[model samples]
Target: MRDINVSTEAHILEAAFAVFSQNPGASLADVAKHAGVGRATLHRHFAGRDDLIVALTLTAAQELDEAVETATAHCQTYTHALEVALGAILPLAARHMFLATEPAINDPRVAEVYASQTRDLTHDIDMAKAEGAFDPHVPTEWIVQAYDNLIYAGWAMVAAGDATPKQAAALAWRTLTQGTGNDAPSARNPWHPH
Candidate 1:
């Protein structure tokens, strides 16, 4: 009985992520339809939209924490760590990107987790700069914001069928490290002088 309830709850959460991610204004009925569960089932698990959003936010936070931990583990260089982290995180865009602009983020529980994650990410950015993996001249806060925006862009590309998740991750890493420039002598660009 407990196992069945757990499965049902997970299904509902997955449906909620899909529905809410695409349409933040989607109703609980939409989630119920997506999950193939009745409206009562969703309400049984989540008392209201706020309750469901909180659950999703917490789940996303836990997934992100795990991804960062796994990416940092066994990586010899900060560059590699960042790449691995991007690869791990880009796929989760659909699951968490909505939280970026969601009012639910202002919730105390969501804010606490996000604050901790930011602190950890800031520490990693500082270490990356010290190790010469990231530009030392750039502000750490700017780098953090850029990293986040890049993740969103990568997700958008993937969502739009412009690139696979792996391709998007690679492109994001390249854009971050190399910028959008062609230094080849044959390349035609006003910015480049022969």
Candidate 2:
């Protein structure tokens, strides 16, 4: 009985993620219908729509946190770390994009999740700079923002069925590490010798 209830709750949360990602203003009944659960059952797990959105946001933060940890563990270089993390997060990117646009997403708990990521990104940027893998003059924040924007763009491509997740991640990595400019070894080259 307990296992079934737990499973039902999990189902509802996942359903909410899908429905809300497509439409943030979707109601609890929409989630309940999507989950194939009665309204009563949905309410039993989440008091209301706001409660469910919060749960979804927290779930996204938790998933991102776990992905970062996993990527960190398996990565040697900072580029590898960022690539792995981008791959880890590609699936959740859309849901997060939706949740982040919500007003209530400013919750400090969510901020902490992003703050932790910022710290990891800062560490990786410093490490990459030390190894001469990234241009020293580029601000860490700009690189992070560029990486983040690419992740979202990659997610959009995947969501539109334009590319597989792996392909999208690869493209994002390539675009970030190598721009469309001339490949001549000059100041424009990311790998230009310092």
Candidate 3:
């Protein structure tokens, strides 16, 4: 079996995330600094932005899977599990608003990671649909569309104004449900669906 170590993988992602967060256009040199590795070392592990993005994307997928696993570990109802899993991603989604846009900041490789993250998100969207967390008639395509629309809308709100992170999360939640929150949420609750 392939040797998989969460700590090491997380380290790599942390480095990549920091760079992407700081400057979506961050160069490998930037990521190397964040990761505390040499350029050669970074290259040894990831050949380029495309490669690094793919690796980062895979890491994102795995961590999200783990988040769901963690949320679902207690053997509780699916709502409990879904909430836990969603919670993990909510924070990240709330925090990484910029990276979602302008993927070619320092490395166009970011697009790869972006794609990976969306794929994992699609999985959760499926789960939510299956469990009726979403409206029974909520099409998977609509969920995908909602994700794209809401992410940009939410991120713009956070970046443009003095909006707090809590406000950002709430905006994302409300918009995802209704895709119609031009302003911040009326209530600062992430779980309150439209």
Ranking by TM-score: 1, 2, 3
- Provide the RMSD of all predictions against the true structure, rounded to 1 decimal: 5.5, 4.1, 8.1
RMSD of 2: 4.1
Q: What lDDT is obtained when candidate 3 is compared to the true structure?
A: 0.60
lDDT by residue (tens digit), candidate 3, 14-61: 888777865778888988888777788777667787777666655555
Q: How many clashes in each structure?
A: 0, 0, 6
Worst 10 residues of 2 by lDDT: 179-188
Q: Candidate 1 vs candidate 3: which has greater lDDT?
A: 1
How high is each candidate's TM-score?
A: 0.81, 0.78, 0.57
Tens-place lDDT digits, model 1, residues 1-194: 99999999999999988888898788999999999999998899999988998899898889887987886799987768887899998888766767666667768998898788888778877877777766555667877877878998998888777888899999998887664222323343334335
Across 155-178, the per-residue lDDT of candidate 2 in tens digits comes to: 888777898878898888888776
Off by over 4 Å in 1: 1-5, 21-24, 179-194
TM-score of 1: 0.81
Please report how far candidate 3 places residue 10 from its true position, in Å: 5.8
Which parts of model 2 have CA positions greater than 4 angstroms off?
A: 1-7, 22-25, 93-97, 179-194
Judge candidate 1 at residue 97 and give its lDDT: 69
- Order of candidate numbers by lDDT, starting with the best: 1, 2, 3
Candidate 3, residue 20: Cα displacement in angstroms equals: 1.9
